[model samples]
Structures are given as C-alpha cells and as structure tokens.
Target chain A: MSGTDDNAIVAARNFVASLPHCRALGMVVEAAGDGVATLSMPYSEALIGDPGTGVIHGGAISALMDTSGGVAVLSHSTGAAMTATMDLRIDYMRAAEPGGRITARAHCRHVTRSVAFVRAEAFDEMPGSGPVAVANGAFALERATDP
Target chain B: MKRPEPIQVVKQRRDAALRALMNGVPYIRFLGIAFDRRGDELTGVLHYDEKLIGNPGLPALHGGATAAFLEVTATMTLCWATLWDDLEAGRIDVATLSASQPTRLPKTIDFTVDYLRSGLPRDAYARARVNRSGRRYASVHVEGWQDNRDRLFAQATGHFLMPPRA
Candidate 1:
C-alpha cells in the first residue's frame, strides 16, 4: 500500500477508537496491515456473567469479534462506512474464563462493492497456547455521507 | 423398556417447553432465556449491560454479538417448533434442510445494523419476526430497540440447513 493508503488506514483506526463502547471495552488496535487488523480487549470482572463460576459471557466474546472484524474492513477500505452484520456464526470451541484477556485477530477475506467478508479468532493468553473461540463474520459497509 | 410416548405427545409437550435444550451456557441463563419462548413467530428481548459496550463514542452494542444472538434465537425457534423432527429423530442431518433452506448460512455471515435512533444509554430492546416455509427453511426479521426511542440497532435474517431423516 502507498504511504497515503497507509495513512488513511491509520486515520480510520483512530476514528473507530474514538467510539465510546470501544473505549469501555478496552479495545486496542494492536496491528493493521495487508487488509487485516488485530484487536485486543482486556478481560474484566464486568464481563463476567456468572460471578461465582467466573465464566465469560458469549455476548462479550461476540462483541470482540464484531468490533475487530468491522475495524479490519474499515482499515482496508479506508473509507467512512457503517457496518451491518449480515450473518455471524460463532463456535464455542472452549470456555472463556473470566479474568483472562481475549484477543481477536481479524482479516478481510474479500471486499465487494457493498459487502465485506471477515473472519476472526478470540484467544486467551496462557503459558503457550492459541485462541479459544474462532468466529467468522461478514459485514456490509455503506459509504458514509457527511451532513 | 416402556413403550415410547407417541411423537404427537412429545410435540405437544415441546410446544410449551421454555428452557433451551442446550446446557452449560452461563450467559444464556444470565440473560434470562427462561423468560423467552419460541413460537410460529418467535419474539424475545436481548438484554444488554455495560459489558456490551465496545466503543466509547458509539457506546453501541457490538454488531457480531447481535448476529450471534439472532442466529441462536432463530435456531431455538425452529427447535421449539419441532420443525427439525427428522433431525431430532436421527433421520437425516444435512440433506432435507439443505435442499430447502431460507437464510444462507455461510461459515461466516454478516449483519447490517442501522441505529435508526438512539435510546437510553444503558439497555436496548430487540424483537424478531420469524417465518417458516413448509418444513423446509425459516426466515426472521430481527430488530433491536434502544433508548426509549425505536432505534434500529441491528437487523438480521438467517437460514439453517437441517439434514434429512434417513
């Protein structure tokens, strides 16, 4: 990508980071390049649906997948766009325990005129292992119009 | 062994069962899935808390989370309606359903949510209009309402492929 394209991608990431929920979720853009972005969300007690058992909610995991996937496409397109999830399927390979940070690596597999396909995986960092939940997502992006 | 109950008997009972058959999902219970039920037309609310927030500027519910909820909701509706009786009976798992499916289930799917209007800062209300075709496939129009006002947070339509009974 040209320097201009790279700068546009950075600007897009900054814009998404400015969203309120992104900040609340503690989402960070770890890396962005080649139409892919890796985002991370720190595990917190607030994410615990079952306090006693300390199990992370599926909703929380899904949230991470959606944001990371959306941002990945946004960074790739380098345009102001609103994302709508056409379909998302999540397979819970294993339980995501509370207090364990989950990171999502999202990549834009394909981008059509109006639709973008993305896949992401959420993993907890342990001694030496990979992610837990693998999520596949598709997002439809419409060019944003400024008022 | 005692004679098994008639299929009709099981179907009748299923119509009134509220609990999700899938077990060990902590968040499903936390979200109060017990209060919800599936019908010819399934309607339910997806409760959201602070944890759902992803971006501070939007403070909006994450889109992928919304999609997963919709897929599960639609799947449960089909299960509750006993639409997949053949699959449940171990007749066929992939054939019959795949032939006549409504929503397409890619390994991964995308959802488009439009924030029609913003609602209360905390909770959002969502509903789905489910439609099924003669034991084949099902389609749903789901909407999320938030901020007292009816802002369309997310809308989804999904298809599940059921295998045929042997």
Candidate 2:
C-alpha cells in the first residue's frame, strides 16, 4: 500500500509487468520492497493439469516461484537492476488447490559480489495446508557499472 | 485388435502415441508444446509466441516457460518409454490409447534448473535423458536450445515419482 520509494521497486514492478510469461500466467505483484517480493496468480481453467481434478500444474507453480525469486533478487539494494537466474531448485510439497489463487513469496537471503540467493514459497490460499512448492535459487546480478 | 509386427506397429503409430501422451496433461496443451519423435527419442518443441517472452526489453523467453518446457520434456520422455514398451509388448493400440481416459503423469518430487543464457525469441527445443528409471522412481535431465543445439540456454534435472503402473 505504499508508493515506489526507490528505483529498485520500480524496476522490479516494470520487470514483472513486461514479462510476457508473467502476463500469460496472470501473475500480479502483491507486495515488493526491501529484498522481498510477493506475487499472486489467480486460478483459471487454462492452468489446470489434471482435467479430472482441475488442479493447477506443477510446472505453472514452477514458473511462479522462479519469477518471484527473480523479482526479489532484483528488488534488493545491491546496485543491480538486472538479474538472471543462475540456478533454481524447486520441491513440490503438495498439489495446489483447485480454483484457488496461488501466492508466491520470495526473500533475498544474501548477496555476494556477483550472485544473489533467494528462497520462495507458493501458497494456494487454503488454510491448514502448507506451501504447494518451495524453491531455492541463485541469480547472477549485473550492475550498470559491472565490467 | 489385429496382430501386426510389433516394430512395424509402433513405428506406424508413434506420433499418435505421443499425441495421446500430451493429451493426458492439460498444461502441456495449454502451453502449446508439441513433440518430435524419432524411434524412442523425443524432442519437445515450444514454438515462438509473444506470450512466452519474459524479458520484453531483451525479447527473451520467460525462465518459467523454459523451465516448464524442460520439465515437460523430462516427464514425457519417461512416460514415452513406458508407452513404447507397452506397444512393443502388444498391450495397447493407438485407438484405445487415444480414446482412453487420460493416463497418469509422473509427479515431480524435486527439480533443479540451470539457466545458462537468456532464451532468444524463437522456437526452442528440448530433449530429456532418463538417467535412472525404476518401478516407482525416475530421474531425468533435460536441455533446451534454440537456433543451435550445441549452445544450450537452459538445462534441468528432475526426480519424479512414477505413478503406479496399470
């Protein structure tokens, strides 16, 4: 509920919006600032994996966590406006509930000279059930002054 | 129902079998992913679409799309092995397979993806190698490339829990 106070948040918001895959998956930035970013994707029939159960696909959640982690890394105050995922590891804890909005929250755990570490989780807006998936990632940070 | 040479039958309907496999998962279809089959090998194709671009400034494909494509390749390769074996054993046919309810798909226990380069704005292809496959477990490594096969943009290793065999 706060306006952009820094270039990092603005860049992260623009990055998320301009991403075609984010639009394709209906990802929205719920909150972003201070080395943390949260995104939500509304459920749709097009995202279903099993037509029988109408559960969202694991691959879609994979996309969500990856982007969320990337956003968190980019939003950090590390003087890096651009970041590329070096590697990401995702574990599926459970299938996302059908017809439920899925939210992915990511925190930048640390930043090295050239890499940022991120951890992300996806929740399907269902109480009691834990995260649908969790992701650990490392991203290559590129500052404007990087040689 | 009619008997035919196993090799000949599998060769005759390999594409149909692949199509049937894709039909099993709605997400694969939603992503517009298709398969290219040669004997037992499969190459997953993600054709160029404006919706797949993650970095519009660079005009690059989304990392999530790339990951999904690789993951689908990994799991489908494992699933295809089963379908191939079943076909060779004369346990299934194209018609029955296609008409049957969507079969089970492997469940991903964990997956790790390495993005080596930005995915260019074009069609990308991936092929998965099953590192290990048992009755209940499978491990696969998949690589995605565009324009040139030697220059890979992304690769993934995944462990999947195989669905119980019917």
Candidate 3:
C-alpha cells in the first residue's frame, strides 16, 4: 500500500480508538476509505436480548450502526472536527445469526454546511449476504477552527 | 389535581398488572428499568450502572441502553393500555392477566432515535405514548430525559407489531 493510504488508515483507527463508547461495545474498525468505513462487533452472550433465541439485542445493532455512521463521516471529514448524531433510523429486516460476528459498513452520502448524511447496514458473517438491519443517519458536524 | 373515582380505581389495577409484566421480562430485568405509573401513563427509569456506560469520555450512558430502555417502555405502555381496554370491556378478567403472560409480546417493526444532547451519567428517565394502536400495528413515541424533562437527551419513534387479542 502507498504510504499516504497507510497513514490514513492509521489515523482513522486512532480516531475510533479515542471514543470510549466504541471501545466499550467491542467495535473494531475493519477498514476505512474516502467517505466509507467498516466496523465489526463479535458475538457475546452478554449482548443477547432473548436467551431463548440467543439473538443479539436490537440495541446492540443500533449502536453498531451509529458508530459506523460516525466513522464514515470522519472518513470524509476535511479536518479534525467534533461530530454527533442528530438522528438515526434503523429498520430491522431480520435477526442476526446466533454466534456470528456482525459487521456494519457506512457511507457518507452527502455533507452540508451543518450536517453529514450517512447510510449503513449490518450483516452477519459476510458483507455481501443479506443485511440484518439497515440504517440512515444525519450527523451534526462542527468544523475545527484555526487558532 | 385528582382523577375521577372510577378512573382512579381502574388505574390502580392496571398499574399493578403492568408492573408485574415488567418484572417478568428478562431483558427489562437485565436493563434494570423500573416502571412508574401516573394515571393511565407510564414512565421508565434506568438507574446509573457502571456497566451501562458507553461513552466513558463523557461518562455518558450507552446509547444502546438508552434506546433499549425507551423501546421496552413503549412496548409495555401499549400492553398496559390494551389490557386496560380489554378489562373494561369484560373481554378478559384481571385474574387471567395477572396469572399468565399477556396474549403476546410486542415486536418492533422499525425504530428511529434522535440524539438531542449527550446522556449524562445518572438515573435516566423515559416516558412513552402510543400515538395510534390497532389490532395489527401500533405506533409509539418516547422521550428520554435526565433531571429536567424540558430538555431531552434523546427521543425515539417506533412502530410495533401487535398480535390480535384473544
């Protein structure tokens, strides 16, 4: 890989590492590129909603998508700036397969002066397979100012 | 302000039924949400638990936990309201509801959450209202707040699948 691309990946990873919520949820940055990012969360018994079903709770899926959306926003960011989600909508298509790692990929579809729009989807085991949940979000971006 | 005597009497029974159902759900227990009844409405509380912290930098509550708390609250509110309606109509007896699970648990079809402010670490509160409910579907809106109700940390709207009442 080119040095510039490698540096961008490192920067992206470092940025995610700085968020406590991402770390607490066991979310890992798989890969990131201009306006796109992928994150994965491993299966854990503690995250199950229905012990009878053993499927991960919908809340866990929501957090994964929200985090993925933020990372995607960062990929397209021009400089270091603070970002927070203004709103997020999640549509649960199906339950995640039991005992499988779930991955979410988000793309920053567009950015306005005050907001960044993102779309994300979560899948189990494979990225190309059917998605377990899909989400669209808008994030408020505050650009850093020069001192 | 005081409610009418007949309404008050019915609410007492309904609130007790809802509390019992809330305690039976495993996920509700896991989240440690407590229900409070105000007339015909319900409010849920999520007390501070270190394990629920998602944003340690802000020392904030986990966004997922907040969403789950609201989702469960909305479901429970609909269940309670439906049961009250059935009881008033003499379609189901209070004994039947208290003795067994409700006809069915509400399933979420879609959920949308709006983050207005960072959820600070503390006992968070949420209240839900069923905008519309039918035999096959229900729509609910919920708001999460801390300290001041006027300032919400997050608000969510969701559509849930409601099974036909037996």
Compare the candidates by TM-score and give the number of the best one. 2
The C-alpha TM-scores of every prediction are 0.55, 0.93, 0.81
Write one digit per residue (lDDT tens) for candidate 1, span A18-112: 76556766777776666677788887765554333565655667777877787777777546366656666665565565677788888889888
- For model 2, the stretches where C-alpha displacement exceeds 4 angstroms are A1-11, B1-9
Give the winner by DockQ: 1 or 3.
3
Which 10-residue window in model 3 chain A sums to the lowest lDDT? A74-83
Per-residue lDDT of A9-43 in model 3, one digit per residue for the tens? 68778876776556656888888867688999998
Name the candidate that leads on lDDT. 2
Tens digits of lDDT, candidate 2, A1-147: 355545656677777888888988989987777779999999988877766678888889988998998888777778676788889999999888898899999999999989999999999988988899999999898889877
Residue B118, candidate 2: C-alpha displacement in angstroms: 1.2
The clash count for each model shown is 40, 0, 1
Question: Which residues of candidate 3, in runs, are more than 4 Å off?
Answer: A1-5, A8-20, A126-129, B1-20, B23-30, B51-55, B85-103, B164-166
Clashes of 3: 1
Task: Give the better candidate number (1 or 2) by lDDT.
Answer: 2
Candidate 1 matches the true fold with a TM-score of 0.55
- Tell me each candidate's RMSD, in Å, in order: 9.8, 2.5, 4.3
Model 1 reaches an interface RMSD of 9.1
Instruction: State the local distance difference test value for candidate 3.
Output: 0.78
* Candidate of highest DockQ: 2
Error of 1 at B136 (Å): 24
Query: How high is the TM-score of chain B in model 1?
Result: 0.54
